[model samples]
Target: MPFLTDPVLTAGAFAAVPQPEIPTGDGLLLRPWQASDAPAVYAAFQDPLMHRWQLRAADSAHEVRGWIEEWRGEWATARSVQWAVVDAGEGALLGRVALHHIDLVDGVGEIGYWTVPAARGEGVAARGTSALARWALDEAGFGRLELTHALGNGASCRVAAKCGFALEGTKRSAVLYTDGRQDVHLHARVRGD
Candidate 1:
């Protein structure tokens, strides 16, 4: 069976090239996750806010290494990708940004991000997200990117807005957290926007 429209991006669009490191103008860099980052990632997950929003906490650096391995493997499949947001000067881990749930045929992918406790309030999330969204939508040829966060997360709401992901709508009880189900705000940015 044929479809009415062609895939917005080809299957190997992302896998064809090595994942590139993106520099956020604000002195932050989004780079591929490395095994050496496990300690920082593990420590970041220990923050209460990070633990709460992420819905899981890393028990050990070993576990984080597994995650890094999995994130690296996803690049080969080209279905999902994650980047470690780091300081450009010292390369300290600041946060993470990712394009997940990618659908090449539709040219859409969802964005997810979080900042280390120390990096919060410094605009790391927004800067990193913006850089990745630009790479995904402009350089990588994705037509649209979506960002959804649980309602009442003002920080995340602000990050979404700062990155130009317009609020599309809310999905009631759309996400399950450690506490309970919560409403989710859906934001999006299209290629032209």
Candidate 2:
């Protein structure tokens, strides 16, 4: 009999926890959030492209530190798992990827991510997103993954499509951007056996 067949074990909520590090394509590295990443994350957030494409507004140093603490807590407490993308060759952080909403009972999760400006057009986002989703579905037992983007963010749409996400639909005025309400496209990647 499988451990998954144990009633008591199955009754508890499965968590999207992270080990200190997991391997990327060429590096033996994939780690959860850390306070040290605050600076890099803040710098990445300052990019005009992310601000316009994402709903997040400008964050202060304090906010970035606080965000780091929050993310660390999630990883420590088994709520969510967030990874800082890093250079496989140099071992330097390049971006971030997260299993945002995890519902173990339902076997569903959501993936959100952004790459540093330098990493864009290098397939970093697509590769990182793909690796994270594979981990969730294959190792973490998630049955579904969802991603969304503002309709105007064509790059993100392309990445999602590349990762095998099927466009569910577009909802007008669904996402409230910092500037105003914007249209959103929902994409999903169903698990496969």
Candidate topping TM-score: 1
Model 2 lDDT-worst window of ten: 5-14
Clashes of 2: 0
Task: Give each model's clash number.
Answer: 0, 0
Error of 2 at 129 (Å): 0.4
Instruction: List where candidate 1 sits over 4 angstroms from the true fold.
Output: none
RMSD (Cα, Å) of model 1: 0.9
lDDT (Cα atoms) of all candidates against the true structure: 0.92, 0.77
lDDT of 1 by residue, 5-110 (tens): 9999898777888989999887999999999999999999988988678877799999999999999989878789999999999999999999989998999999
lDDT of 2 by residue, 1-193 (tens): 5555323113233343335555666552557777778788888889998888766744776688898788777764444668888876776778888887666557777889888888889888788888888887777677789998888889999999999999999988987887899988999998782
The root-mean-square deviation over C-alpha atoms between each candidate and the true structure, in angstroms, is: 0.9, 4.2
Output the worst ten-in-a-row residue range by lDDT, candidate 1. Answer: 48-57
